[model samples]
Target: MNREQPDPPAGGDRIRQTAVRAGGDVIGKKVEHHHPAGPVTALHALPTPPAGFTGRDALLEELLAAVDPTTGADRAGVVVSAVAGMGGVGKTALALAVGAAARQRGWFCAELFVDLRGHTPGAQPVDANAALDTLLRALGVDVEKIPPALEERAAFYRSALAALSDRDEHRRPVLVVADNAAAVEQVRPLLPGPGGHRLLVTSRSTLHSLAGARRIDVDVLTPKAAVALLAAILGADDSRSGRTEELAEVARWCGYLPLALEISAALLVRAPHLDPARLARRLAQEGRRLERLDDGERTVRAVFDLSVQRLTPGQARVFALLGVNPGPDIATEAAAVLTGLEAEEAEEVLQDLAGARLLTSHPGGRWSMHDLLTDHARHHLTHHTGTEVEAARRRLLDHYTRLTADAAIHLQALPGEAVPATFTGTADALAWLDTEFPNLSAAAYAAQHAGHTDIAVALPLDLGVHLDRRRRFDELISLSTLARDTARTTGRTKAEAAAWNNLGAALAGVRRFQEAIEAHTTARTLYQQTGDRHREANAVNSLGAAFLEARRFEEAVQAYTTARTLHQESGDRRREAAAVNSLGLALAGVRRFEEAVQVHTTARALFREAGDRHGEAMALDSLGTGPGGVG
Candidate 1:
């Protein structure tokens, strides 16, 4: 092999020259090569599905059936199901559940998830054009090539889906999960036309106007299901502690709402020895319920705040007032009164709230908020409304005060007395008072605490008679004390006198006659200083009643005489009649029968002149039965 062979023939020279020429040509020109773009095999952009998702079996099944690709060939367009509910009602959870199930079933090759940030706190909703750009980019469209306008972007998205559908190798169905969609238009451009694809949307609103979208309203879990969820979260060891009843109570206190249940369960899971009964008792307090439901990052209040942030200013104001409202539910007219809105306008606002699931509508044209939502609204009112809160509260108090004062005049006004034009009859007045009794008390307390002195002073004066008639002495005592303090702080002498007078009445109702006398005496001095002869006369009359109750006859007679003289000077014949009747009782208390009889005769004449048949009857009965008859 190593031996040199004979030199090649002269043909080698031509071969070398040809080879050199080929090398020079290759070196002088560039080579061009082409490769095709690879297909997008899979996309997993959805959030991980919630863990241990419990209940909602029916809703889940319906959602799964809605987006199942096998049925796409039989349908006209891509199936769209809108999952809507109040915040924390598990709207996103249901959508994720269906999405996970679909992925497991191999329903789609291209998957997409976008948080529209519709009602997210501290974030504006995604713009439709921007959202479309996101979808185009997600579909492998280059940023520069993607259309800038919404319509073009939408067209491009559809074309992309069409191209994918036409490719036999990549013609797998697509699944899009749009979470927290704020508005219809925000979602419109993102939806695909008729094809082997589906979209599942979640929002606080129903998005009812979105054409061809099936809506599923996700409500709170059923009681059995809620308890089961709590148990599932607690695991075996904690759930079987003979505290099943307490667990049920815990769920009930959570309103059987899934979000609340999970938060409550988390607390128990952290403290393995913590009694379920203890947690139940803790949640029993409404003021503390929302606080207890917080777990640092995911709070019930935080969940509710997002929905509240989306409200219009008027709706937000109405919601704040609803928080301050003491009733379990509100009639539209009542809400109108609370917010100073026209009834129709207020109803529209309430319906908007109901549509947003911040409020729920009952059959009787009334609206109610969930217990936790009410707390959240109040929280917002306390922190965000600022000076407007004071003004709004004043308006609420003024509304209730005027209506209640009118009601009292209708129910308790003496014949021939001028009263506010209100109520169809005494029965109507009584019914209104009975229905508003608790609210009236709550308003009075709230006003006093918030330093609205006028409202506090006026409230008990209007409500006292009804409360006395109903034997609601506890509320009377509480309201009157607060009124006294508030009036004194504001230095309104007439209001202070009125507050003391009401306080005396409440004290007497509870059989605290000594304190009642002291209160009445204070009232008399304040009235005299203010030069209010009529109220001074009223105060002296109350002072006499308290004296008589304490068996101080001489003091009682002296008090009644002073009241009678003042009433006569003030030209209040009706009250003069009342004072004269009381003087007769004091006279009988000291065994002065002759003077008592003369006083009684004078009282009878005054009562007749005043057209007070009831006062006349009382005076006649006193004449027949002596001192005991007056009371």
Candidate 2:
């Protein structure tokens, strides 16, 4: 995974000058050396559309319809279309496909192409003035005769296209495809003048500054399309239909990006016996996904490196911070904490990263990195950057811990309880928890894995009340287990006892009463050993509830009787009243009718003293329903 070769130099080093045009396409080129400013007898210089190119049917139609008009009416200006996306998302392939289609339609008599080298490695982006020199020469103007200044060269370049279009007969409709432009400045000067001509640009950036340009955003291929493309590259036929599912899995591992897909196909092609299943298993390892996508000549990491190379230092740090975000996406506030930036500053940096296609922005100002890109950023964080990964993770976990504590306060509050100042009310706290639950869950796991034992134990404990209130017992069980195991590892006896109590409640929630009783018993014993009478009383009360659910009424009665005494000793009047009510229910379950009524009466008096109207109503109901009562 650490093989660090520089990305292949783009544009300048890859251009083929000896390539000749035939039938409106670059048919062939001599490998012999040619000058940089060589003469072009034919204007067609579009690279051959990739072999077996597949998909993008709808997008292809959209681009073609925009570039080639149905009527003979003149356009207001040159029809400029820009295809933008993250690296390896097939921007160049789609643009080249459009160029080939336009050529076949005979919409243009001549074509010109340039590689602006905007994000190339080990080389600077082609300068605007230098790009003009290249374009001017391709238009048949001698290098010595071309203007020196950028504006003069641009004016002359536009007029040359205008002159070709202004002809009375044999007027030319030229297509100038500017590939790999990093900025608007590199493209602004290259727009052909008004005629029926057009300019198509492909960039990793959104290039939103291009006025009136029809921007097409290319994302990863869909699973069906990715599989089809992979099959095409592998030349699989109907005989291999059984491998469709395996191939689809490989496509997912590749993130369905075209460049990665092509390299995966190449690996299979070279090995011949490496099946899709084995390849998928290798790719499933996140640490090695980008590594497995390489085929000697081209790598997904190399493509991504070029994009990262273009980012500012501040942006690069933020990008690395995002790598360790354990959830599907991160909010602006969380990102602010992770990067040690103000929310406003972090948001601006996030927007800039989105514009560069390094991150994807979602509604409500959240941002997410693509799977492969996240791996790359983590690699950068580990090897290339000065940022401490553990420190960043701690900040993130602490941020989530504080928010969860605030939410828990509101969740556990009784009716008419004062809401915390951190949240407006119960609804606000609940809403925050609902939105941040996935992130919170991930952060808890991250803390456990990173050995942040205290936060790991505290977070799940804080989430217990909320999960139980929502009846999400499955999630509650999971967090409780994490808290229990994590605490056991650190020998935090008090924390482990608390976690067992929570686990007991969650198990009872799902009717696993035997397991619930065992957990609560362990918690009670631990509490007794620690000399905590209040928590011990709480654990006994939970154990009583589990026994009652399991219909062990005699055992429930004994547990509640002891629990009632513990609560009284601890001066917990409301819990004492609760224990009395449960004791009455157990008495009735064991057919001790008169004792049940007498206990219910005492429970009613206790609830009245404690101002627990809900408990009093429950006790009155129990009195009526007891054996041999008024009913």
Candidate 3:
């Protein structure tokens, strides 16, 4: 057997740990440092979970949907899920339940479970090569004959597993459960190639980084459900079943956590003298009651410690910084700003944190720790890292402001002048706007709170085109009003005109023409007030269009004529021609034959001079079929 540690980057690699698994809780001293190097030629297939555990009906359905056989090989694709919730949430129990359920359903030819030990304090994760070696052996490879080097071992591992799943597009079913993984890459090498087998993984952290993987958010068990679970575990015979209600109190006190409940039950077994009544009373204390309530070495803190202790200094620092973020998660870019790492490096670190079960990655690359974990991370940040918690938060918020402002501008405007967005992830970008829609509104509200009136006004105005395209009319109304009020607050003349114009357009899209005309008139008035002659002309032009649509011909003529005078004054002959065209169309509506002909004639000459063939043709067509033919 050859032993060399897995080559983790300078401070980011692996070391072995020896922890005692007491009642499925990892408990033990930290092993002296040794790299968890290359795989063992010797192999051992692991034991499968026994049948029957409660919970996870919803999880199983989602997983089955993700890996449906009708979807065929993709069904056999990696299904990474996180059983994330507070400390007492039944994440591990849910994993065990799913395992038991999968076996009970007879879905796989064989089953294997390996704990990646990502969240364990000092426990080193099982390496991919070592995992594959064990997989091949479990599939019945002889220890002496197995290959040694990484490449050969992987090939043999893939080949030996290939027997269970032929090279054909579809094959036999096997289910591999990688329990408690720390990263997307770590679980990658062990994936059985295009086999009929499916892998159902359970982790404390969300694994959204894994494409085509199903994510199931495990929450606290319901009060009724928790009571039922304790009843099933701690029944004092049929006669003493009145104590079912007592277990309910125990469940809540333990935070409806399945692991905690199991431990609470184990303690009752360990101490025969303690009554369920007394145990419930002891757990009710507000202090660090976790020590008293724990099932044994498998307390929530203990489970977390194994994963925490395994981290190198840098990875440890990242976990600490993330705990202070305001929201449940931060985008990878924001995390990069917080950690002073580049985006790619930040993503890799996030994956490590997630794989270690110290943090969770959500659908849009947002990272968060379980609430209790965040509290722990905050404590560590205060005492260990020299970086200020507030400083990291301030930097993250600044980065978010810059990114969101940039994105808003890119999303707005006609494509002619706007920059093409180079998004980190196209799927991620869209999902970020969608998932953070509420947060964006809150951000707008926050800008006002910070007394940044210009940003408050400009940010919403910047979103006009995208909102129009998306038809989020209600949001448009809200944002438009925010822009309008903000500009007013800052006495920003140009911004007032812009916001009023946008509000008018948005109102018009919803067919509130009267409100649009009123708003457009307000914009025109503001432009005129500010002596912004060019914007005044443009606003008048918009007003004319609206009047024409509303069948107010006389009003339309007045607006168009005013615009024509301004364009003429500005020497913008093309716009001058457009206004003359509008005047011609309005004149024809009122049967002013001679004036209409005169207007069309001017428009034709201007179009010809401008080399606008299409406009010239339109003018010629209108002039010919008019009430009075052009002389």
Q: Which candidate is the best by lDDT?
A: 2
Model 2 misplacement above 4 A: 1-293, 296-298, 383-387, 613-631
For candidate 1, the lDDT comes to 0.66
On TM-score, the candidate that comes out on top is 2
Poorly placed runs, candidate 3 (over 4 Å): 1-54, 58-254, 258-330, 338-340, 356-359, 362-440, 548-553, 571-631
Which regions in candidate 1 have their CA more than 4 angstroms from the true location? 1-299, 302-317, 326-329, 351-357, 360-367, 382-388, 627-631
State the weakest 10-residue window (summed lDDT) of model 3: 20-29
Clashes of 3: 20
Q: Over the stretch 1-631, how does candidate 2's per-residue lDDT look in tens digits?
A: 1110111111222111121111111111111111233444337888777665787898888888878844564443232233343676777778889899998988887778887867643224666776766666567764434554568878888887776556626676778888888888898888776777788888877777877677777777899998898888778553443489998987877777786776566556545677888777666654254465444213466445545655688988899888878876789999999998999999999987775557767777788765556777887887544447788889999999998877766654545555458888777887788678767877888888888898888988877766654434566788889998998989977778878877887777566789988998998988888897877776787787678767787998898999899989978676687678778877887888878888889988998997767567767876776433412
Which digits, one per residue and each the tens of the lDDT, describe model 1 over residues 1-631?
0100111111111100000001001000000111223322326677665555888899889878878878745232223333343566777778888888888888787778876767643234666776665566567653334453468768888887767666637567677788878788888787777777787788778777777777778877888888888888777666543467888887777767676676677666656777777777666654254465444223355435544555688888888778877545667877887777898999999987775557778766777665556766787777545666666667778888888877665555554555566787666777688666656776787777677777877887667655544434456667667777877888867766766776776566556879988988998898779886767777888788777666788998999898899879988776788778778878888988888888988988998997767667767767866653433
Model 2 weakest lDDT span, ten residues long = 1-10
In model 2, state the lDDT of residue 101.
Answer: 96
Error of 3 at 188 (Å): 44
True lDDT of residue 188, candidate 1 = 78
Q: On TM-score, who's better, 2 or 3?
A: 2
Overall local distance difference test of candidate 2: 0.70
